[model samples]
Target: MSSNSPFPSLLDGTLSLPVTPLIRGALEHSKKITSPTTVNHCIRSAYFAILLSQKLARKDAEPLDAELIVYSVIMHDLGWAVDKSLLSKDKRFEVDSANMARTYLQSTKESGVWDKHRVQLAWDAIALHATPSFSQHKEPEVMLASMGILADFQGHFIANQLITVDEFKAIVGAFPRLGFKDQFIGIMCGLCAYKPETTYDNFVGEWGCEFGLDGKGTGKEEYAKNRLASTFPRTLLPTLIALAEYENEAPAE
Candidate 1:
């Protein structure tokens, strides 16, 4: 679609552009169901993954599957859609999005292009993208996908090492952030409201405890109790309280 190069020098001619019907279908599906902010984020994440792979010279060790990468990244956040029917309460948002991506892959006209192994790779990437320790050790597809996501959200310090500032501007210029930080948190909070257990033991749970889910507290007391119980000395209680208060007042941006 957009002819913008993800990385001016690294990914200029190395990576294959997604142009097949299945890939196009995935992009269209993502745009229809997800917000523009999310769709842009997914595109940026895919590009970032490719750039990271090129930077690490992992193309030969772990070949890039252009179609699979596009499909996986584009659909990774679909579970966070405002349409509750698209998500599953029985699973975490990550698993829900992964399952949806898998199902879409299985039903595509070019489904044969991706075998069971490839499908599983994409699934694992989406499901474990939030867990660096786990995803970083998996297959190239999984690891790179997660890295791309991390780079987009939390890798600002390492951006210079990964790609040039001009390249970064090009990527974000094409797909603007558009208040992604606050919007993403709001989406996670909504997920917590729908399925509280899904957020437990994850970063979303911490956000819930800090911000309160849908303006209603979700396990705030339990989270506080756990923090208090885990602390070694009661003497640190006042300091912890002060820090928590400051954090609560701090801007999420």
Candidate 2:
């Protein structure tokens, strides 16, 4: 077992959340350079990403993928570990996270079997997961990348299992601030692909092959309304958690 942080453990065909050493280190590093509020947001984003991935996987009848989902979510924001300058919308964060993932995987070759393809898939997924708009082709990594991105954005609407409309608005407010509106919108389209009730298998399949899913339902308007009504709330939870943290840390006179 690596001592850096506890790795997520699988039991009864489900994964239990494990402390991510990489994420913890990133959090520590981020705190030094990022404001307390931003650091809290980062942590909340990661947590909700993990939770949302599990929910989506279960909803799609692909519970076996939870551990992979957890791993990806924990490290998704870890590019912030290396350089604060990479904190914004720059592509450096993607490259930095990808390189860090490569190093981590290479360093732990004995933990499990690692095929070149699987490793590459993991690397690519982490690298491109944050940028949905740029991925116009379908691939295995693309599915995982979509999963990661969807989980990240949807986490903004959920709180303690209850979805808040106000928090959803706040999340929308913060969307353009992150320079990720296109990516978020792209994931929404992906989620509604094939049909409104599309399963996880469809999600995985459509990931690397195309820009948008089958576009089921009446049209874009109805589809958008449906997606906003069902899923985005679960996604919003993490953002709310981070906001709560910000409130807790407010300066007192």
Candidate 3:
């Protein structure tokens, strides 16, 4: 991609982090999709995944294997890029995504830098990120899968931010599971104000918050905290914490 090209600009909107051929391929694939909505969502999700991964890396005490993890998450939806129908929670799609990552990586100049084992890991992570049920591998695979799921979730949340207040209200009206008002309150309580919530404290204290969600409320504050608190088998809290800090630093551009 050209440095001044829109593709690079689009990619540049992502977190400043390492990317692999697998990730690049996913973006290229996203460009080819026939539907504007799907293309937009996938593109945003790709950027979201990169942002979340970089945020997580920042908060880590030890250096993270971020390139590998972020690359895996970016490629998680490759199947959807190849065929819109592959967006479903089906085995074929999962395999397609995985194979796409492997094929793309191998076809690129970076292929030599990554060994066979690393490529295998990438394949496994990209493939199962969308289908955790199919994940039997551990470590990077699990991490990648969790990142992908959370990326998708956070992408939707970010996408909502782009909508008008009325449009957002309509979205929440259609999807009550989002708990719009509650989530908004939660975000306000945590992020902007950086204050604790008595309600979240009470709920999490009684229920014992998983990650940071128990008493975190359900607003943007909670969403931020939830992003940090979520983990494997639940949500990736560490990753969210990193992302929260990164979001805090994002330039207004």
Candidate 4:
């Protein structure tokens, strides 16, 4: 396979892809388990990530790791598969997907190509893709992966800021949306149905609020109840004498 292959032009330059056996395997695996809509979404997100990297001039820093970006983006949503066995009840869907990707990356015959640190980067990118506050400040691979997902889901706002209309059209043309919104929502709801606790305080919580699950109340309501129950009342504090005594014994900051 070629070390680098030309991708569709965006932002007046052709994107160079690092073709590798791992990347091909990731794409194939994702396609087999995920719906066509999801596969297309993953591919588009990879393109968006590349475009965002170019827009931010990250390509100049150290020659962005195209293989890593593709691996991270393509495998980011593997937890949303219809096969519930792929998900975890104890962790959020993102964690499950990240773990799954990490295992796959480590299992490859040429796994030596990716060290522990590189695998960790991919894990972080996949796990934090939905969190802008975290991913936005992380490494290029993490940040770009998040940006790509955001741009695809909310293209109305992000498309104009990063790429031209022609570029946006090209990406969508390559991978059509094909009712991804409803399908994605259904996937989240199904996950919550199986593991409602995973939705608390996360983006999936918003989905739970929007679409009521079978037995579980709106996630927002449950989250609010938990927050209310966990807090301590200010009125229960000790009097001034006790406060002063504690303050005197406390070490200086």
Rate residue 1 of model 3 by lDDT. Answer: 38
For residues 178-216, what per-residue lDDT tens digits would candidate 3 score against the true structure? 343354333323222232232222222222233243335
Candidate 4 TM-score, C-alpha based: 0.80
If both were scored by lDDT, which would come out higher, candidate 2 or candidate 3? Answer: 3
Question: How high a TM-score does candidate 2 get?
Answer: 0.40
Of the candidates numbered 1 and 3, which has the greater lDDT value?
A: 1
Q: Which order, best to worst by lDDT?
A: 4, 1, 3, 2
Candidates in descending TM-score order: 4, 1, 3, 2
Among the numbered candidates, top lDDT falls to 4
Clashes of 3: 21
* lDDT of every model, 2 decimals: 0.75, 0.46, 0.47, 0.77
Model 2 lDDT-worst window of ten: 199-208
Model 4, span 1-253: residue lDDT tens = 2424323444445754455677778888888778889988988888888877878883349777778888899999988876787678889888988999998887777445777789899999999999999999998888899898888887646845776667778888867999998888777766666787677557775675666553235454664454344334423344554578777576878
- List, residue by residue over 83-126, the lDDT tens digit for candidate 2: 44443342344555676666666675332565787667667666
Query: Candidate 1, residues 5-84: lDDT per residue as tens digits?
Result: 33233335554446667767888888888898898888888878877776777434745786676678878887877688
Better TM-score candidate (2, 4): 4
TM-score of each prediction: 0.78, 0.40, 0.44, 0.80
Q: Positional deviation of 146 in candidate 3, in angstroms?
A: 3.2
